[model samples]
Target: MTTARDREILRLAVPAFLALVAEPMFLLADAAIVGHLGTLPLAGLGIAAAVLQTVIGLCVFLAYGTTAGVARHLGAGDLRGAIAQGVDGLWLAVLIGAAVTVVGVPLAGPVVRLFGASADVADPATTYLRIALLGTTPLLLMLAATGVLRGLQDTRTPLVVAVGGNALNVVLNLLLVYPAGLGIAGSALGSVLAQVASAAAFVVVVVRAARRHGAALRPDLPGIRAASRAGAPLVVRTITLRAAILVTTYAVTVGAVADDQEVDLATHQLAMTLWTFLAFALDAIAIAAQALTGRLLGAGDVTGTRETTDRMVRWGAWSGVVTGVLLAAASPWLGRLFTGDDAVRDLLVPVLIVAALGQPVAGVVFVLDGVLIGAGDGRYLARAGLVTLVAYAPVALALAALSAGLVAIWVAFCTVFMGARLVVLVHRARGDAWLVTGVVRAPK
Candidate 1:
């Protein structure tokens, strides 16, 4: 029998899953389109994507923090205030995005080289990075706006926007890449255009909602400061998480070099893309956890929060099993869909299987991470993330030094990085310490 809580979780998680899946669909489209260009181009996309994701991933706190703050206010019956806080988050996104562009675009060449891109791969990677940089503001705005809607318990809007944007991206990539003869540049441009369109759609939705609810559209200085303060620890948390990802990318690149295995690098990229896509699918439940947990706490329903956490965990674990089965079954065919390289596909199969086996662990970590964020436990999350990174580093370093195959690298990801995440998160979630409720604290 499905209770109201079960209905609520599914209501939020199902759409959130669709929306999250659309995100990686953009990248999947890019990989497929660019993969046809040849190995160097595909490799370049891998390098460029790592850099782009790292920068944007670091600022993901804009969404997480805003969602928590907005949900809390909405729970406390301050709908207008909730909208105002979300507006402040959008403002911060623009500010950060601008600063990143100013520093990132001009340095694209050097950045690609830093990723250990071979000379043949560097130019295209640099081209892709610089072009993608043009859309950072729009991407950041979309992240924050999505968070705002999620906090309001509305995931359907984001799902529609994301799905439509992904379809547009695919169409544009088809037209611009071959017909326009723009090559990898066309792929990057298509993604940028899609991001801008999605951001515009979000703006229209948010502005109308604000006007309807009498929320201030203009920026408020104190509110902005308060949002930033609440997000500070989240920023730290994001940094650590991004660092883990960045290091993994770097380790894979360098490890392939050490082993004189260029094809393995491409295979790693293909497998990692699948890994990330699956993660977004799992993160949908996390999004639900974040929203509902925040609302429950605001309503002073600790009992509900606890119960919801248990249900989400159970759902998450089973979802992981289902995802793993599907991924493993598809491993043989999955790589061929992305790239035509036989060598790359061969190497990708085993690596993907290893990744498949780890989905349950991934599901657990993602949900608990969201639960803590929703509970406004960013301080502990930040510190715990750093500790997890420290624990994972030696394993990553050893894997790189050993010049292990793609499977070993993934094994490190599962056992070292993700394992550490599971330990810390489970330890916290089992305790009552992370169940904080009330208004978000602004740092003194």
Candidate 2:
């Protein structure tokens, strides 16, 4: 028999999974459209996308933090407070997004240059990045708004908006890239416009909820400060995580260039893109874990929290196994969809297999990460992220230093890096430290 908890988990996870997959579809669509342009353009898109994702990834605290805060308030029977907290988070997003755009636009060229990519690759990368930075504000706005809705236990809205936005992005890219003849810049412009539309839709929905619940829509200075305070540890945590990825990317670039193997760089790009897609897909359960853990803790239901955590862990592991099997089966033909280069496609196969083998570990890490986040255990998470990064960095750098192949690089990341994360998270989850039950998390 399906218990009420199981039903709720399904209700949230199903839509959340769709929404998460849709989020990565934006990148996949971009890769597909841009790949046909030329090797240089595709390579350029890889560099630009890495920089863009890093920025967005760093700001993810807006979503995770807001989700926990809003869900806790909602569970505590304070709908108005939940909406108000979300409003403050939205305001923070606007400020942070604007600031990022102002700084990022001017540095696009220099940042891409930092990768030491050839001029042919750097030129298009700078072009795409400069245009894409214009959409940062709206992108962050969407993140904060999605957090609000998720906290309200309405993942379906995000799924609808994300799917619609992805469809629009693809259509616009097709029209602009070829028919309109804007080249790679056209792809960037299309993505920006789609993001703007999604952000607007989210804003409307969040504002309606706020008005209906009589929550003030104006920016609350103290509230914003509080949100910032709560999100500080998460920002550190995300920074460390992003740092690890950036280091891995840097390793790939350096190793490829050192070995005079340009195909390796492109192959790593494709592998990373696919890995991100899988990560988000598996994160659907994590999304459910985040919302449920926060709400359950807020209601002071300790047993329910423990039971739900265990169930979600199982769901995450099984989902990873199933996804891994499917990905491994499709690995042979997957690279052809992104690029026509035979070299890149061939190199991608083995790298992806290594990634496939790590899915179960990835699933558990993502879920436990979400569970702790939902419980507002940001401080420990922050420390753990740093520790994981510290342990993994040397091994990755050593591989790069030896000029090991791309497959070796990915093996280190998937096994050494991911394995380290799994260990720390498992240790934390096995303890009672994160089981604090109340509206506000108790200090450790």
Which structure among the candidates has the greatest lDDT? 2
CA RMSD of all predictions: 1.3, 1.6
lDDT score, candidate 2: 0.91
- Candidate 2: deviation at residue 305, Å? 0.3
Q: Candidate 1: which pairs clash?
A: none
TM-score quality measure for candidate 1: 0.98
Stretches > 4 Å off in candidate 2: 257-261, 441-444
Task: Write one digit per residue (lDDT tens) for candidate 2, span 382-406.
Answer: 9999999999999998998888868
lDDT per model, in order? 0.88, 0.91
Cα lDDT of model 1 by residue, 41-95, tens digit: 8888888888888888888888888888788888888899889889988888888
